[model samples]
Target: MAGMMRRSLDAFCITFWITVFLAAISSATPIEPRSNAIQELWSSVRTLVFPPTNRCKVYPGDPEWPSDDVWMKLNKATDNRLLVKPQPQASVCYSGPFYNAEKCAEITPVWGSSYTHIHDPIEMMSPVAQGMTCLPPNVFDSHNCSRGGFPMYVINATEPKHVQLGVDFARKTGVRLVVKNTGHDFLGKSGGKDSLSIWTHHFKQIDYIEKFEDKKLGYSGPAFKAGVGVQAFEIYKAAHEKGRTVVGGEGETVGIFGGYIQGGGHSPLTSLYGTGADQVLSFDVVTADGKFVTANSTSHPDLFWAMRGGGGSTFGVATSVTVKAHPEMTTTASRFSFTSKDIGNETFWAGVRTYVDYFIPNADAGTYAYFLLLPNVATGIFTFSMSPFFAPNKTLEQTQTLLQPWFTRLNDLGITFDPNITQFDSYYEAWRSSFPLEVVEKINATTGSRMFPRANFETEAKREELYQNLRKSSENNRVQVHFNIKAVDPANADNAVNPAWRPNILFAQQAVRWPVNATAAQILKIRQDFQTGDMQRWRDISPGAGSYLAEADRLEPNFGQAFWGTKYARLLRLKTKWDPQDVFFATTSVGSERWKVESVDGLPNENGKLCRVR
Candidate 1:
């Protein structure tokens, strides 16, 4: 029986390989390079230019899928694939994962037309064909910024074969491939000039679950595995529905494996369980060569270690993540606010700062809060925007006592607030409202997650300097800079996801929304505003501080220092090895064309050749 089982598995893998190869070629039909003399040059820009979407396509049948025809299967899938309506002309060609196929191709000639219709690649397709262009005017602006660059058809993938096919082609073709989980990267990594984008949004599959009683990780966790598209909020909700719970982000739309986990996911529950990465049990990924592989403590240990917090550049396409689960417990969430009168008073701001410094670290490791700072320039009124959440179940009084110091200080400033607290039926219920799981599904036709961990969340001394600077800048009108820090727990030591993000423990976000395409005057106004109020506020801590990838602003230079922070070097080394040829790249990637491009550990470059460590 064992021999037979092995044979069966081997046969399925072989068949899967053959099918993907055929599908990859067939899908190129609609967008094959013209029989022009520029075929060679065009190939270099293959992923960048859309292959004319006019040609015959084909595919073969496989037993597992039952209908091994590539072109045919994809045609069938498109009909079933959900296409969101009410799309605007500007938005369809200039934004995120387009919900349809044809439009996706028109915008991303290389990835869309060439890679689309390929059975395995587009099976989980999440095409975002509509968005801004490289042309001019407001053409480059996206929702909050002025550039998402040229759109890349994110070939949303799910099954290992799907990822395997896309990556294999990238390695063979030398086409610049931009990989995206949820198109949520603030750095605009998932798309770039003449880039072929592969989307992992459609990679939503939950294969296994472990009850806390079983402890599949051997005392390390109440662990289970899921696809890359399984979001933090979705995981929380799923666990809650099953009467279980896990710690993760507090947002509704954040993807679990996209940027948040890649950086280090955090939430109110982190105080108790730790960051989402800390809880991973193992990870299964499809490498650049089309191999379906696993990374865990016992297998591919070094790669496993690196994936947790090293960042995404070192590894290939990761499809699913296995995470640790904890016992579900009760919890409390509370909200408090302050008015303009209290905010305008410097003494009040100082008192609030003093209390926050004292209370933040003193709050039980399980308790967490982030003050949302907003300034109403029209009134010269500043108000305290605070959002707090915690779990392991606490009463209103208990939660209030932890927050009382700051609460009282606000009253001293003429700020008073009513506390809102409710007992959640389960952690998932709380998770749903807090994180909004379905938001990912709503925002884009597809979904995925990412992580961005920073060594320094922030210090109270830093906060004081920030407010002081802002006070002076207030006279100049530049206080729109967003600064924030939220507490996070460590990831489970045994998680089996990508190896790049294993060491992160906290998450931070900072944003400056001036103008999408601020004119020279507008740009100057924003800069002047920050120079006085925003920039000076946090300038003291600026040297070592990092910014969030998703809340990207173009002004920052050497993004590696400002975003990846401490672990930048490790990511570089891994990137050097995996992408020795720099095949998978974009303007915002860790190892950009400008990087030294050295061999790993100072080894001599193998001249485009690399050895597999895992």
Candidate 2:
């Protein structure tokens, strides 16, 4: 009787809860489709199963399309800063009622301006927008380029809350998320079709700390916090005013906190200090879970390590970054140029090898040369142009003394060249005059890079092989070589930059371009020339060395090993932990191997869905 009484109590408890649940469900507005058995069963437990919020995202032409209610809610989330992508330039070119030559001519100078402009709607820096079928139209074509490869909507994010809102929206609703700041992405990562973009260009917050404290790293120093929209020139100006400088990019308009530093930023000061990623102290970011937090040595340390050099738009959206700063210093600037017409190809390359041989000594003496090695100027002429070199904390006399050997060697080889050297009062002035606005031009080229170690210049045979391979590749094309020997010890800092950069003296790159009217077959050949054909030449030289993913081939084999070296595994693990659902995706980035972009009509484009591979 006692056991029966206990069983009756248990049954009574269950029945009581069921009656209460049913009463609650009946009182509340019922979910439709109660006629279905499964729906009825789920309705009873809907309160516990689903949250009281809408997580549905509608595609174009869907039954529940983007209705007015949807737009109203999205606009409220971002405080009415949401925007629909437009094509004002397309209207100026071929979409107007009648073509306006005056407007078209007016926009030519500004064509390249949109590449770095934070507010530009264009997806590509190049005039010929790749991966688009209608873009780069012919002069006689009737139609203009539409928003084929650009984002469907953009949130002009100005604060951490804005980023969090966008992240939450994209996460709750299964939509692709991309970040755009200045639109300076080399791999076209700033744009994606049928996606929602977080335009962080308005998140411009800069702060300086004279005595920084980090209990995790156990060090403190002078540092600056630059927002996501902070460009190179802006940071330089601010640092100069503070009587200090920071390691950054050469492009004046490139965002300092975006893919530049995330991809192991190299600079003229690399030999003296280190790469930009090395100087980072912390980052304030919004993760895939829609939480804004700080990542540093002590807080979210794994995210900090991965974010330093693991490439951007893969883990989360960065709101701002704090990096170390250095005191201002004077520098000796030199500009030199010579032609192969003065010396034939065989002798010219021999002279080139001799010049390259001095990279170690120059780097040791605190000199970094920003030069270009062009094998062909026209029909049979090659050019070696070191437009402006930096000799930090050196006087005019010391600068000339350092360059005297190079001059003497050129004189001995009968190579007539102009050596234009000067001294600057500050590094800012030197960088300003040396690396100008890059002379904006309409270019449609993809590039592949290789980091050549200092050992390549040690032996005559190695140098000969390097020069021979470069000459053969540039026989009918152009390959530009940048010689900046990074002699700093990366072991001092823990980050994810390519290991190959630690022992490299030069960064060599080869690129190919195609016309707007080029056939699909021709475009494929151009891409293959860089990814497979030209890359093999450099691979033969540095079999173990890796390339910079910021300017590397998209078709690179074993890209994880090439980009991250031994850190690939750790990075992949952290990527999974941080973004298990793949909220962020950039081509060739970590964990991107799991997804493959859709191909359209035998051509690859972002319009199609990014389907999972495995």
Candidate 3:
């Protein structure tokens, strides 16, 4: 078997992936051949690290045509086609020392080692985990680039065997293998420095949509693998064409099954059905040991329990997610803007408090909602971007009545409620029409901070005031700031996803787009300003306030409370259980504190970041 494997590999690509499998290690131990599955696995990894022309190709008749026989045989044949090669004498290095022009030259054929179209790291991080542009400025720019600093490694996985091989490789290399689809991270946890990300972005296969048979449920959706990249709008649009709708992302561009749903996603139909995450039927995941598994209520129950809301990138890499899709029905879309600077801050605050107090108890849990408190200085008008998409089985008047107070008070305050309203057939068309999916995608890719699901809406007036102070902060600086709120109802108590999911009421707040850039000095001010404002807001609101770990800052300490809060300790055990070697890691990833102390074996490697798997 060994001789055959060697001869076959040499005939193919001269040890291509075998070199990666070998080069991945720092040692020169003799190689050994094993199962044919191992052979196919290496076949997939090569094209990924050093892809040729057509990167993401779909297998004929689909990979899982009958759910039993996938692309296993084809993958094996392809593996035989691409011969493995020897590793380069020296290890590949990312452009370092903050401006190595020669190293940057090494970055040519940019995607030479990349799996996606990344001219820079920012494109790679997306909005969730933007690269720190304090110095050289191009957050994504890398000389001789191999690292996205986000640890995103696209795996060209063909079969379950390939997935296991990738997992084994990551385990051996001490690289955290978080999964990704379309790189739509609201918080930057998916990719990080000192991490090896297994990007599912290339895995675009959708097996089947076993339509709901229960007539009473009136629900029909797809049982999809997480690799599907077409957005909620794409699938919903297709479903709409077929008289079906799935609860999914508002923007047509957001990846449907990627981290969004798993991380608690919301969309236009949210008001009607609930969050995209709530509609999940099951998750197809690859565990820490490289075994393929399904997570729900019964299988690997603890994992099922964690993936729901444990909020850890290290939990597992999910390939497919079966989600609930809904039918396209009539929907009303309206934009309510408040055109009055005379709308005193006090009045606005009181109105917000009243609205929260009133709606938190009665606003239908499934109703999608939000209210933006903005003072448009140009028009001497204080405006709010408040739009409530009417849920199915509900009327515009009924939604108006439920949320009437929010507008009536302002009307009484002498502001006209002349808002723009539109009605559409499919729930998605309306939401997709209004949301800047392109802009959102542009921004969503860069959103790095994650906000844990908030069960309640209660923050001091000071927080609002601080936001109001944002205009002041921007008054002298070059960067501008904005904030948004995502109000979500609590998941069913029986939900086994994450205990934090129990915080039925949740909201995400963000302030981004600093005043300056193009210069290190300008970038520093922008970063400092963002940090200062963020810290002040937290300190003023709740000095111990916690946010999502995905988009948290690289240097913010004491995140045990802020990111994980009460569940910090338990996540540790889970981390230990799955990643005992600390193979899966990020520079400041959640569970790495345990390994911060020097290892009895040696000093930290050049990476400075720990590599337990090493």
- lDDT by candidate, in order shown: 0.46, 0.72, 0.46
lDDT by residue for model 1 (1-614), tens: 99999999979876665565445444432222233322332233232211212120110121221121322332233332312121222344444553344554454443323132222221212122212322111334334322223322334454555555456445444334556665444434454322345567666666446543324345444555667766655677677665667655665544677556655555566556555666666778665545667876677665665566544533666777777767676666665666557445565456545553543343343665545445566777766555644444666566667667656765675656775765665666554554322211111111111222232225655556544544544344433322122333343354322222322222323333344444435544554454344443443444454544444333345657654666667677776765554555533346653532122223111111122222
Say which candidate scores most in lDDT: 2
lDDT of 3 by residue, 1-614 (tens): 99999889766674564465456433322124445655454444333232111121111142311111112432353343211211111113333444455543454333222233221222343332433311121323323433323333334454444455555555543344444455445444444443334545445565447563322223444444335455565576566666667767654556667666655555556555555666766777776665677876556666665555454356666777666555567665566655335666556544444445443433343455544444444454444556443344345665566556656765565556565656666665666655542332222112223332233344545334444443343332212211223334433423323333334332334444433324434544555565566544444434334554443454345656555566667767776786554545433444756443222222111112333332
lDDT of 2 by residue, 1-614 (tens): 99999999979876665565455445532323323432333342323211112232234554434444454466665667787754535345665564567766666455456443455644555322225533323332326655555777888888787787677666544566778887665566776666688888777788989989886665678899999889888899999999999998777888888878887888888888778888899999988776778999989999999998999998889999999989888888888777777577777776776687677778777677888877653577778778677887787889999889978887888877767778888888888888746422234466677888877877878877877777776774756757566747544778888888888887787766667567667776777766667778788788888888876656667889888889999999999999977878877899989876664433334554555674
lDDT of 1: 0.46
| TM-score of every candidate | 0.65, 0.86, 0.64
Ranking by lDDT: 2, 1, 3
Model 3 regions lying over 4 Å from their true place:
1-122, 125-153, 175-178, 190-197, 207-230, 268-275, 325-329, 336-362, 371-383, 387-393, 438-491, 494-508, 512-545, 550-557, 586-614
Residue 409, model 1: Cα distance from true site in angstroms = 3.0
- RMSD each, Å: 13.4, 8.6, 11.8
**Model 1 TM:** 0.65
| Model 2 steric clash pairs | none
Superposed model 1: Cα runs more than 4 Å off: 1-154, 211-219, 342-344, 347-351, 362-364, 389-392, 434-463, 466-510, 515-517, 520-539, 542-555, 561-566, 586-588, 593-614
Worst 10 residues of 1 by lDDT: 440-449
